[model samples]
Target chain A: MLVTVVGNYPKIPNLPRPARLRNAFARLDRGQITPEELAKVEDEVTIEVLKEQADAGVELLTDGQVRWFDEQTYIAGKLGGVEINGLIRFFDTNTYYREPIINGPVAWREPILIRDYAFARDNASRPVKPVLTGPYTLARLCRNDHYSSFEDVAFGLAEALNAEAKALAAEDPPLIQFNEPAITRHPEDARLAESIWRRLLSGLSGETAVSFYFGPPGDAVAAALNAGFTTVGVDTTIPGVLDAIAAGPKPPKLAAGIMDSRTTRLEDVDVLAGHVEAAAALAGSDNLYVNPNIGLEFLPREQAQAKLVRLVEGVNKARGGAK
Target chain B: MSKGLLTTSVGSFGKPPYLAKARSDHAAGRISAEDLDKLTRQATQEIIDLQVELGLDILVHGEMERGDMVAYFAEHFPGMSIGGLVRSYGNRYYHKPVIHNELRWDGPYTVDMWKYAQSLTDRPVKGMLTGPYTMVDWAFEEYYPSRRDAVLAMARVVREETLALQDAGARYIQIDEPAASVRFDDIDLAAEAMGIVTEGVTAKTITHICYGDFAPVYDQLIRIPVDQFDLEMANSGYDLLDVMREKGFDKEVGLGVLDVHTHKVETVEEVVAGIKRALEFMPPERIYVDPDCGLKTRTWEESADKIRVMVEAVRRVKAEYAIE
Candidate 1:
């Protein structure tokens, strides 16, 4: 059984350079630091987080998103004709995202996450799956001033992200994870979400996984997962997800997120194994992969690391990977 | 000026094109330090005169020097350093403050800016500071043992500046705590921290809280020792007024009659209708008129027009009531 992270590990707090790298970015803006120095600092942070995930026995490793400001904004900032606009509270977290404003036709004029993924893959012992904020989530989150409709903006974003995804796939990464957290927010926009999801994962290499968290999606998540993807990344930590998963069609691969990501409170190992077992029963053991319900950036570093160890162990125990 | 409805902004104004150019040029090192300061001072003076002409009872320095509300403090203040940009909501972003050491007063932060603006206008200028709870809430905390510890430490640091601003002859000291609304379970901790920050201060203390649901913490919020509550009423369409009526908010309420988030300016009629709904719960004398939040997101024209419409609406209300 494969146990991987959804995306984003907790930040290494109290750095002497800048407690958070966002402040480091500010210093760079003031010309206190050179672009080379900033890139070096970012890579150092990436190494620490990537090692932490690998140490915790995370089968499919992530870059830990150490350089990421939040889910959508960091990648959105790099795209052409997109403006990083106002400060906004990022959903329910204490963290905030610089909201993206689409000013013109969105396309990948330059490579965004290729370096981040390449850097992570080199440092990691396990195969790293580069995580991208999905087109649907990005379009949903940003103010689409340029695009005619939500559909137009979403597809526009899809075309841009499709470029980045294709670039990462070319690097021979085992998989690509698209975090469509917006799917849970506007579940009513299911058809719009599915169309965008299809476009995002149209021709990517290896296993392609689209995940939802914060809440359950309507029918679009299930339809899209079954249509063309290796995994259905469901946050079973939420109340309605089990019912949603049981009621709907199953994907070829099921990434059941049985661990809580928001709080530091540790889930009982037996209870976590039980959750894994139930999901496996539905999807069958071969199809099941275990993970946290969402990103663990909200939790403190130690707690997040401990939770990772537990999630991997619990999934292994349930799948009978250990003696 | 005190007789009729008091009019002011929630503090920031949109930076004009020239000022924006100067800021970028300074950062890019294309301009000298003296050149940047001269341009900023000019912008500040222009806004001060503009506020007076707009007939606002209270005047602000227009915050031409500030990049973001939280970042401005984090940069100037000691014990904090400006971090990279984090997303706020929509397309907006601000640098989250990083507090690695114990917070110190660091001489005077906003005092010089406050004094500069006060000298420009005869009207009482607000010595604005992002409150201790918000400082603690928004920043990445590493030194403190608990969030409560971090906040109280920040409160003491803020209190030093508050007293300094009072010494500078500022009457209205607006300590904004927009982050307080986010913490529902620990609302009391935030309130207690605010109390600690404002403890033994003589300046008229006003706290502005917004963006989150106030229904859950309505019971704990009213008891905080502040002379006024500058709330985001227009965004919620005066829904908080009903809560104030139910739970009894005795402090003077800054009725945010204008929405600053969008470019669509509120008509004078829309402003009056909102205040009319608010008047049903709050007395006009106890009301202060302003926008829902800072106008940094909006264009200069939009910000100016919204304030003018708000002031006009308040004028109509005062005339109808036959107040002096």
Candidate 2:
């Protein structure tokens, strides 16, 4: 079984000293340094987190999302029609994200995350996956003043993000994962979510995945599978979610979210192996990807790194037990 | 000027340079606890003097004695351990605490600070404590069987702290529940915990909820068993005021006049416009002018400048209304 992480990792490491990211931003705010200088700090942290993940035995890596401020506005703000607003709580987490106000037609002029992807790929030893906030989730999270309807907003974002996805695909990464945590919360929008994902992945040559988290998968699992994503990432920590994913139309690959990323507590290898085995039973071992239920941004740097170590061990234990 | 439309801060003020250095040195073990405490008290005195100088109606101790709102209470509570860092926002992080066992209130935590702050001034110092819901929401839960159980347990702990503050002659106590407005589905749980927290508390209870889309929880939030609902108005462009006007605010409001998250000190006209917008919904007596949230995020100079502008705006509005 392959062990990977869902999107973000903690940018700051566990240390007695303050994070360089914080200090750099503070310095930038004081006009002591240029934006280029601050970007250099972010790049350093990104490489650090990438190395940490690679060392912990994670095969597939994300940039740890060190460059992006938050899930919504990081991409949404880069879009033509959107303007970043004041802080709002990002879902149920204690952390906050800048809200995006959709003022004009939501259009992506250029590649938003392509540079970060290229940088991570260049810096890391292991293969890196480009992740984006799903168009539907972005539309749902932001205020849509311009769109006449939800469909108008979601489709507009999808067309824009689709162009960006194609741009990232040109770099020929291992996979591109669109994190649609908002879909799990509002499963009634499953159809719209599926349609948007299809639009986002349209004409893209590389492998793609859609992950649902922050809530139970509900009916969104089947919706994503039907949307023709190469992989469907499900949060199996929610009761009966594993069974629900198994019950749904299995995709080419299954990203089994067995680990809880929100808490600092680590899971036992045996328990994790059991989860992995169950996941492998549904999607053959070759097609299964084991990961946390969501992003590791909620966790401390030490715990997040430790969880990945345990994850690798669990995957190994599962393979060993099968042998 | 009338005491109506009184000026007050939500909770924390930005820590001054000396206090900030002292906290860092204390954390690094370079300074003794006594040294840190001395500086903290000195900083608190400075904050009180600043607020007094600014001609504010109510004042805060500036929270120099504590770190993050949640971690400070977690340090005092039994069965809790302050854990590693998690980002609160852009480049801002706090050590999220872990509830490892059944929680218990060892003794009063905020009473001493509240007493000290109150003693420094004749003005009624708002006794501040992180609300039980916010503490539970912010921290990593490892002990409680359910969130509801943890929330209620924390509510009891906070209630004890509240009563202690009340007993210590605190007339105004602000229980900060910033996390309450985050989840609309769990607003009942938040409200229920607040009920437990304020049970038999005689002081004028206030709960400050900020930074989220609170429109869904506004009705339930208004009924959160507090005397006043302190909210952030200017940060979100005073859009929340429309929601409050439609919902009909029955209780007093700690109206946030300036955005604390940004360094751009709001102009007197900008603040007056916000307060006037609020005045359209609620009377001046029901409105208490303040910043959007805690000024802890801003630099000390930024916080002071923002407060000066806030006070000036309130002064102009009070003068215009002749309410006092």
Give each prediction's DockQ, rounded to 2 decimals. 0.12, 0.63
What TM value does chain B of candidate 2 have? Answer: 0.96
Model 1's C-alpha root-mean-square deviation from the true structure amounts to 8.7
Off by over 4 Å in 2: A16-48, A72-86, A99-126, A142-153, A246-248, A320-323, B1-3, B237-242, B245-249, B263-285, B299-322
Residue-by-residue lDDT tens digits, candidate 1, A48-73? 88888888888888888887767877
In the range B234-280, model 2's lDDT, one tens digit per residue, is 87888988998887888999888888878788899999999889888
DockQ of 2: 0.63
The digit string of per-residue lDDT tens for model 1 on B105-127 reads 87787887788888898998888
lDDT of 2 by residue, A25-135 (tens): 989999999999999999998999989999999999999999877888789888898998888777878778888998999888988899999999999999999999998
Q: For residue A235, what is the lDDT in candidate 1?
A: 87
Show how many residue pairs clash in every candidate, following the order shown: 22, 2
